[model samples]
Target: MTQLSSNKASGCTGAISPVLIGAVAAALLVAALLFSASSPGRPSSAARSAKAADSEAAKRYHKDIKPILEEFCFDCHADDVKKGNLSLNEFKDDADLIAQKDRWLAVMKNVRAGVMPPPGKSRPTEAQQRQLADWVKYGAFGIDSRNPDPGRVTIHRLNRLEYRNTIAQILGVDYNTDDEFPPDGAGLGLDNIADVLTTSPLILEKYLKAAEISLDGALPSEKGREFSVQGSAFKGNNNATGDRLSFNGAPEVVFAYRNKNPGSFRVQMEIEVMAAATGTNETSTSPAASGIATNICHFVVGVQSGVAPLAVLLERDFTAEPKKHQFVFDRVWSIEPHVFKINVTAPGIRPAGRGGGGGGRGAAPPVGPQLRITNLRITAQPTAEVRRFFAKDAPPAAAKELQDYIRQGVAAFGLRAYRRPLDEPTLNRLAGEIEQRYGETGLFNDSVKPSLAKVLCSPRFLFRVTQTVPAKSGEPWSLIDEYSLASRLSYFLWSSMPDDELLNLAGKGELRKNLDGQIKRMLNHKFAARMIENFSGQWLQTRNVMKWTIVEPEVLKREGKTAGKPMLTDEIRQAMKDETTMYFARIVQEDRSLLEIIASDYTYLNEGLAGYYGIPGVQGKEMQLVKLPDDSPRGGVMTHGSVLIVTSGANRTSAVKRGVFVLD
Candidate 1:
């Protein structure tokens, strides 16, 4: 498992000194004034002819630049690693740079070319450029570096989608119930990373409820059916009837009986299983045939009276009719019963019989059915005691039985990207809280309801909790209290709680000092899957894609689209999801520039999606990464089906929303 971490730089190795910022700022101001004086926005004939002379004049020192340099340069070119090493630490006036005239000219040159500080960096305007030309004429000055005031901010808990994806990845279970929890509040223009996203009592209740729902299991339906076994004894022992029976849909059992079984009886059972189909297959628009193996039922003989049932016999090695190639489980049984009602008990199987007159001497059930009940012959052996017998597996608890559920909450809703392992005490306390909520409130199914509500609601989970209370006298103090810091750093960057490795680092007192290594390790973690899910889903509005339901055929035709044509099926939705996931995955793995998300030459699409976009030759349900045509405006999240649909309003796309999404 890979660790997740923040992208922030650490240790400040070789970082630009603070003094350089001031020097650069001064250089920019002077250069801006010089450029303005030399060039006009609309050039005149005389101005163009004097360009070379103006340029030479701009390069001169002391005679034309001393005053300009004194006003701007002396404050920042002091000796200091304070802001990118402008080094004004020793000087107080313009003469300092004047003594190093060549250095001042070099600064003047870079500033005039508009390349010194770089765009988005501290740079000079046209007016400042003209001043720089004048400063070179007067000579340059050194200045001290000044630090800016720090910005104030709040930390936030992980959002709902992130929390959901994180838990699903951790537990390998796709339980997306986070939507039922209370909505997260936005901070810093994003619900995901805001420190202001705190939890409330209602959220705690939701968490507990979600936890219970995630862990709880329930018994199969209680409804039962009855059938009969029939055969003609036309041959010797073991050669009478070729009975074949099977069961399907949910795990269950079967029963068999013969009228002349006054003594001993024997029966057989066989089974075959097929792979289960997923949600996508059920909603496929294309029609193609697929076959599945018929599961044979395992019969358990039981004596039934009123609503109670007692085991009557157990089966051994028995083969179903037809061939062995189509067979799976083959077991046979021999039993002798006295004063016990014999019945076949395969809950998930349906047998074919003739009369439906019940299994009696002259009564017969249906026949030639997909399920059979032959191999019937009674013996004259003496009846055994009604004490006990055997059957298949035991019964599970019904609705009336007691149950406890445990829900693993989502990852993105907490400090996910950090490395922190919750202690046993924490888990136990959480479990206790879970138990209390269920037992006290009588709402076991909604355990996650309370689990989410409580954890997300708590200040302990939401706040970074950086305030350190000193240990009492004679008590041992922790080394740096890195656990709190670890928690803060992870939530700040990754927008989720730390995992075991991170927590372990904090425990070992390594995270705070070794932030660089920890951050690197955390970025490679599997839970980083949560990062893609949360960041991309919410930011890209991929969650809103499913709401685009199909309307009437007339409406479709009016929109210049097909009505009878299958628009978005379950398969297509899943394909779109795969596209979203793949795109997000690339962002994390490649550490790609975020700007690529606004406009890229390539996108993920399937045949259905390709058709929707009027692209040709794409066929089938599988999703593929395709290169978008240069002519198409469809690129990145703005053009993605999910994102576009999500940002759209009723009956039309809203430019305002799309614009805000792009800007945000």
Candidate 2:
């Protein structure tokens, strides 16, 4: 990570640069001279000439522009017609036309893109179209070149997904902000656009509550404690069935624990091993005359802290036997929470069935050895340093150390929250708040939690605030600061705050220079997959599939369902949605051509969707990539069940809707 100097040079600084001041003075002088020349009493010769020129231009508008619009546009944009709510006939003069510049701009954009004047309609000649283009470009109501306004962007608040992901990255704690916040409104097929992302009193209240919840989950508890978490609570085993646990390699079981206080912690596992079943029936009176040896189950139990990747604290193999076993793991470290995993291997042994039912009388069954975890317990005892830091009765000697620790923690957290280095005043204020809280609460964790929550709720954390740089004289646009650029890129690609590498490059002012490399790196990052769900979900309108109803008469009859409501099960709808999203992800990840979005030779499918599409060979609940035959009509997102269902009406397909979607 390269470090860059902080960007303090912004347009908002109090003192204006000499060049800008001069340019402003010149503009004022010109404006005053024009006003004086156009004063009411007596018009100068120059003013008369300008008036004559304007009249000639008005004549040209009526002759060239008005005639063309009447022929090619008025049929749709006239007063009685007003297609798209636009009445070109209302603009009688230049002022009226200029006032609605944005509408005219849209017209110009469409004309240039060749999307207007729908196919099969009488089209305007090239010469007539160019005349209209010139009228908008160089006529009296023309846009100003010197002050070309690109429009303003509304200040953006992080949406629910962004908030959750950003908090996870910054605090190393996963939070579900979606459950706490109201759904965000979308615009232009995008929910991230600032204009539609509104805030209300309820949203503000939710933010406060969410902040508190996030802080509580991230921060450690105030004191050392002991607790027991069921081993089945880990990843794999199902306690409801009470079936014997079995794994070929690493057991999916993982215990996640947060160490609030740095100290010596103990983890104990109470596991019961079942002997390998050698015969088909447990009630069999005798074994085969050959006397084959029974299979032995081996397992390696280990504890690995989250802070140290792949660092195992305890790892040993034990033979499976019919008895209870206890193992204790001890680790002394000052770090965040950790996950402990167990690995088991038993060759030539089949896994136990979900239920304890034995096989039918005639056949031999393949059963394997298994381990049953009865209990898992953990306890933490604070070290001397931790004890002193949170001591109820503080001594004078440890006061400085505790304060220093608090200051460091505050600074570090503030830097991450703000996504940049904080100014002295800001850092001091945050540190002071923590100190005050500490004075009130004597315990370190209790003191820091509230301050941390306050920081999380701050606008700096909630919004991506960019410093606006003022454009100098003759400059067409202002350049965004490096930190701002970094945030935009990260949120666009990863839907989260910039990681350390990105932030470091921004600090060194080299982010833009190395943008291509960064982009390539980010594309390969795990979070880049978010683009498929966030962007494609909206772009292809696949999210609407959840609300779509499969009401085709034949289809409804086949499925035995009523009309006017969603007949497809949630699983089928989800599978349909996944097909499009995964297709998009594959295109982006594999760097496929953009045209593949319209027509691809392959698609993703699961058993449910495959059966619906009449595609054979796919036979599982999980989705997999499959090749489409040349004659298949289901090659692109346009034909996918997700898109087809959503674009249709409750009872039948709407040709108009499908056509408009294709055009869009």
Candidate 3:
């Protein structure tokens, strides 16, 4: 780990400063002015002389350049042999070649760099290469910069992370439904790329389901939710049998419950465990020590979504006589959909099956060495927030009538859902759905539920229509609408829907005013923390660092390392990730140069990361900015443990992957 973190700078570092941005903008303005000044359409004296020069260059193209091309360059680029997708013969003359300025520029750059002749076949002399580059500049294909024809903007949809983040903000709850949604397609090394985001029927279904849970959590039900174990839909067991459901040894017994609202839950169940006798008193028929084991057995009780690890609410170890035990976790906070799990593991003894009446079965369940889960009940408990927010006394949004309440509720919800102002038609359409549902059900939640699902499933919510726009007529560029700009800013910076401030500015069509100030403010916002994680995660592929098996205990064993210090512990790996993300967060919050990301004299570190990098003085788990040792060679992302871990091979560090990580 020290070696990984002590290497010199590698991957991306600090961003370009505002001053550099201003300088680049100024240079672009100058170039654009020059292009305008040398306009070929003008009938001025300058335009006439430029046209004369073009005529002379076209004449020289056949005589002077043709022989040069045939001598040293045409082997690969000639007719019927277009290596590098370049065929100089395709261009009729300088005018023809200059029409495709991008290709011409690429050809000129390669020739100028002297990488075109490719070091093998009869190479051109240094002077000839110089002459050829000059000819490209002032002779046949006189170089000119040009912007290519604009293409249609790709439509973007909120990726899974963005959707989860937006739902959390919009609904005030941490909702994780990523497993429900299909994986978002990535493009240009980013999952948020618009070109790859596409809507499908499956994703629409997931969106509707997500919206229902979000709305249900936002407007919680007072009655709460309950699930009983009898006839419950359980998996990983013998079968879906009722209270008789029991499994022996290593088999699991999972009872699932789809928690509708955000709240706490209570799990009450009776587990009957039975194991074969395996002690000094095994042969003894005495009740005191029939089959007490020396080794201890343990089990876990926790709530879960999918395969999340168990959290202990209550734990105890007992001897053989205590086969049946009651477990009641008074309250476990559960916001999203999850299942109550009771995992029991009894080691060092095989599960004893039904015995002959000779010795009689152990004082356990009918099946020996097994766990019988009976009378299981998982009930959701309403938190104080839920109790106050959805009190029956108050009407939705303070509207007196149910209809007006539904309309206001839908409108307010629409603003957050759409992340922009709703048109009259959209408002009517959404409100109409709720009103129609309310008419039939006569319940506020029932009306809101289906209508909210409708809103979430709509294309307006699924895809970003604000992004697609045509350039203004007769102009090469057009200003993005403020709403579109807001979407871009929020999604790129915050990875979520626009906040109230951005939406307010967009609504007023004034986001473009003092745009630089807004960018700075956004960079300083707390949401910018997500940008540190999301952007740097995608850029450096640091997300892969969490797959901690890259350099595990097994790696050391497999590599025949007899004895060594562990390079990474779980805490160290976690600290390594913190170091990478915190470093980027500092860059954003401190307004540091982007190049600093490539190399920096200081980095964020806690005690674990500091010792891992051989730096002293850092204390505690809380990370803080630490000045790097002068000769430490620990200056950039390339040396970070997260980066090195991702780039490492099974049993050793991958020099090839490390090099590619730096170059790529």
Candidate 4:
């Protein structure tokens, strides 16, 4: 009898009752007895009968199985040939073959499925095949049944894209990790694959830098600068009368302001609009269509930055008299430059004959209203109250308040970073670290920076670590926790951390139930387009087109004859890559059948690519969807210039390479 008390165990220090111990011991004894009975030999008569049957099967392997393999499989899988990296010639006995259990299992599956000998190859007799199956089934050379092996996945670090997007979502600030960190390794045609995304000392250093940069954007340390530019400085199309700027239909004047500081800013525009010449017959119209006689100039104001998309800020009608308009933009988080645009259109026009003929006798046609911009100013100033939260020196009363703020901030950030709530211990540890750092460095940002950097470098934030749960009775694998499932779904689709909605759903334990709906929502999001660029770029090998060079001497010689006409230019290459990326994005966005990737009636094209493919109608740098003719050969990705050029050699096309790509 075995003692099963937890206290007696080497590592277990807990106490167990004698009754529980006795129950456990009885279960262990029953399991052992069952295992013994199932073995080749035992005292029971059933065990003896099974041993005799195995012995007979063993004899068949030596006499029948070995002969069949040698006659049929040895030709391709022998030691000398070793086709498909397989060698059966080395197995002198069943024990030797059984040692390589996985290989033999595959052999059994292939042979039994009638795919091993291959088409047109001589096959073994039905009796011989049965003997081989019996040999494997009866445990060749005393080996037990093979167990299924589900491969393990290694811990994956957040790639550059994931890091940037995750930080943006967490902090409400944009930080480009790709610019600061080294490029991640691409294995299995994806940078996000678990086995390939490894951590290193250099990567940790980069993470520290990235954390500091992100924190700085979130909490600025200095006052922002103010600058202004003149609207006359902007380049615009010259009208017939070039005295003033004229916007016929579209706004041509663009004021590009490079914002060096990250804080609040105000933009002011001062302009004088020329009065419109009313016709003799023109009368009062609807209130919306008509405004104050002298004040009727309508202009649309918008702002755009590299970090975010363009946003229209204001649209209103201004007086023709000189006036100043001020617009206030708050919290301006992007470090990238911004473009403030003012789109002004001429006043409503009167019909040629219905309104009144051209001015008077010989007078020229009444000139359309023109806009003259006298001043355009931008002033950036930090919010003093908000800045106090990140101030280094704290007042007596606010010190404790600041400490609480730091704790809450770190906890909130950790929840997003880890994609789950932090435990009490972890929260306390981080808060303590921030307090200690604050004591060492008086600056609030300085203290928070190091603590946040540590969190960013920590394994919990860096890697997607899935907790292992014990499998329930009769189950082969354990199910991942709700939080883990949320993270997996988000990272798989968006290449970023789960949003607050996803986290909330996971907390409520409803993520799995609503997973399909959540996936559709995520696919519809604008960020999901990253999948098209990052995934398809690698899987289709279109990204490599930029790196391809014409190395063939003959190709170079032919290119020398056409000095100005290069076979492949950077513009043409980019257009080709964009074509494939846009096509893939459309397929996902429209939920079209994936088979369209191989054969579709339409593709995206720009002027450069359209010219390259000899297709007419495309006339601009912007890419647009174009329908292909029935006889056109450029419908799918395989026919795209980027794919064709990358797969082809410098001088000529490789039929074998194209064939292999199609087959793959």
What's the TM-score of each model vs. the native?
Answer: 0.45, 0.63, 0.58, 0.62
- Could you report the Cα RMSD, in angstroms, for every candidate shown? 21.7, 12.9, 16.0, 14.6
lDDT of 4 at 589: 74
RMSD from true fold, candidate 2: 12.9
> For model 3, how does the per-residue alpha-carbon lDDT over 110-174 read when each residue is reduced to its tens digit?
76776777776676677766666666677544444341222345556778888878766665545
Off by over 4 Å in 1: 1-158, 162-176, 193-201, 211-464, 467-480, 488-496, 548-555, 560-562, 577-581, 584-588, 591-595, 617-620, 630-633
Put down candidate 4 lDDT per residue, 182-283, tens digits, no spaces. Answer: 888988667888667766657755655555555544544433345666665655443222125433333345667765544445566666666553322232
Better of 2 and 3 by TM-score: 2
Tens digit of lDDT per residue, candidate 2, span 275-322?
664334321212222242234554656666654566655454445557
Better of 1 and 4 by lDDT: 4
Error of 4 at 194 (Å): 3.2
Local accuracy of candidate 1 as per-residue lDDT tens digits, 1-664: 1111111112111233244334334443453354335331222433353344344443454454444444445445543433445543343443343565666676678678876555655555578778775555442432212311112333334466555544333322233444466778765546765544665556544544433332221101111111123432212122422232222221123333422211122223222222322111111111211122122324443433223345454442223343322212211111122222222323222333312322333222111112333433332211121001101122113422222223132222222322333445655565566456556655442332333333333344423444333544533321226776776555544655566666667778777778988777766665556666666666666655666554446556678977785666666666666677778778668889877777888878878878877877777777777887779888776677776665666456679978887787
Q: Model 3 lDDT vs. the true structure?
A: 0.62
lDDT of each: 0.44, 0.65, 0.62, 0.64
Candidate that beats the other on lDDT, 1 or 3, i.e. the better one: 3
Go through the candidates in order and give the clash count of each.
135, 3, 11, 0
User: Could you say which candidate leads in TM-score?
Assistant: 2
- Candidate 3 worst ten-residue window by lDDT: 1-10
Candidate number with the higher lDDT (1 or 2):
2
